[model samples]
Target: MTLTLTALTSPPARVDLSPLVPETTRGRSAIEVAGTAIRCGRDRVGVGELFAVSGYGTDELVLRGELGRIDRIGAGMRGGRLRVEGSCGDHVGARMTGGEIVIDGDAGAFAGAELRGGLVRIEGSAGASAGAGYPGTRAGMSGGEIVIAGDAGQEAGAAMRRGLVAIGGRAGDGAGLRMLAGTVIALRGVGAEAGMGNKRGSIVSGRPLRPLPGYARAVRYRPPALALQLRRLRELGLEVPDAMLTGAWTRWAGDRLELSRGEILIFDEEEVAAG
Candidate 1:
């Protein structure tokens, strides 16, 4: 069974809808599911008051309408699938340990912050801190994968401890800020100061990127890891060019300010053209 929720009105303030995921709604009746409390502004309200809920007792959930103020849509989900047909607000899939969340439109800030496992795919752009850590925490996005088909705002993978974040479009400044571990692949250009303060991680840029002062170019070579990752991206329906899959990449290692194990790989245009 698949549950469907259609929002009747745009939320006035941030609404935490994490309580309505498959884990909590799987065995409940429509009335019970609708009665689930959601945080709206300073008050708690039944989901039935905000959206029309239909179907129940399933692991699949479909949500429609504009949810630009809905936060924590799939927080801590361990299994099942959630599909959003319209734009979603901040923290779309924060701390989800498993399952899948697909957003057909744009997502606001912290789209996948603190994710532990699972897959989150955004067909449109994402706001800042897409895979960042919670406030006061040392790590963000300990696991899972986030695929942004459009541009990503600043700090796309900030403080991520593990997992993968692939952006098919340009990434704003601070793409991998303070990243401890993980991989961030930006297909288009990346803004200044990417990989800042990174301790141990990999930032692969397919477009032009000026070397940051905190980094130092190490070498130029074709890494086997790039081929494997590109293949995975291709499986996700992302167009990974032949050159990118089999090209020499310039490796720059630094953010020497930290543990110094972090690396930034910039694709060599000349190699791309030759390929």
Candidate 2:
């Protein structure tokens, strides 16, 4: 089943989408209705005043027209697929624990903030803190995966405890700041202070880096786990360059200020000759 949403007019106030039924096990069990329509909510306004809802099914949900103000499109979703055909506001998949979300356009700040499980793929760029922990929260993205096809803003994966984040384009400053455990791979160059104060995690970059003074150059070796990581990225529809998957990486361990278990792997050209 497919539920299509077309905006009738620009919403005067931010619409609250919590009232919409979800595809949870209990919700699907109770509601016999397969599809629903929603429109911009105004002061004392009903859904009929805004947009027309059509379709009768539960398998798919599609959103059309501009949605720059519709926040939390799929918040805490546990099942079903959500497709956003246009750009959306912040918190597209906040704390989502299951299902898949594909955004065809750019997303606002905190795109996948504190996602616990499931997969979120963004075909366009994302704003700051793409997969970082929420403010005052101890953990960020404890599970699941986030793939950004374009450049990302600051603090891409700050304080992440688990899961994988792959940025297909360049990443902004503080890419993986204070990460406890997880994997962050940037296919393009990462911003300055890529992994500052990281405790235990891996930050892999496809470009060279100006290693911090405290980070000593470790032995250059082909990481056995890199093959698996790249394979996972490929499965997510990210373009993994042949050079990256087949190249050797220069390992630099640091943030001596912390556990010193975190390391950054910079892909090196020497691997081709050594092979």
For candidate 1, the 10 contiguous residues with the lowest summed lDDT are: 266-275
Q: What is the lDDT of residue 252 in candidate 1?
A: 83
Q: What does candidate 1 score on TM?
A: 0.96
lDDT of 2 by residue, 1-275 (tens): 46566667767866644334247322332133323333344544454444445554475667677778777777788877888897877887878888888899988888888888888899999888888888888788888898999988998888888988888998888888888889888888688888887888788888777665546677677888987899889988889888787778888887788888888888867532221
Clashes (candidate 1): 0
The local distance difference test score of each candidate is 0.88, 0.76
Q: Write down the TM-score for model 2.
A: 0.87
Model 1 residue 195 lDDT? 95
Backbone clashes, candidate 2: 1
Q: Give a tens-digit lDDT track for model 1, residues 1-275.
A: 47899998987777999887888888788888888889999999999988998887588899998788888889888999999998998998899999999999999999899999999999999999889886788889899999999999999899999999999888889988989999998888678899999999999898857767788878789899888997898877677889888778888898899988999998876633211
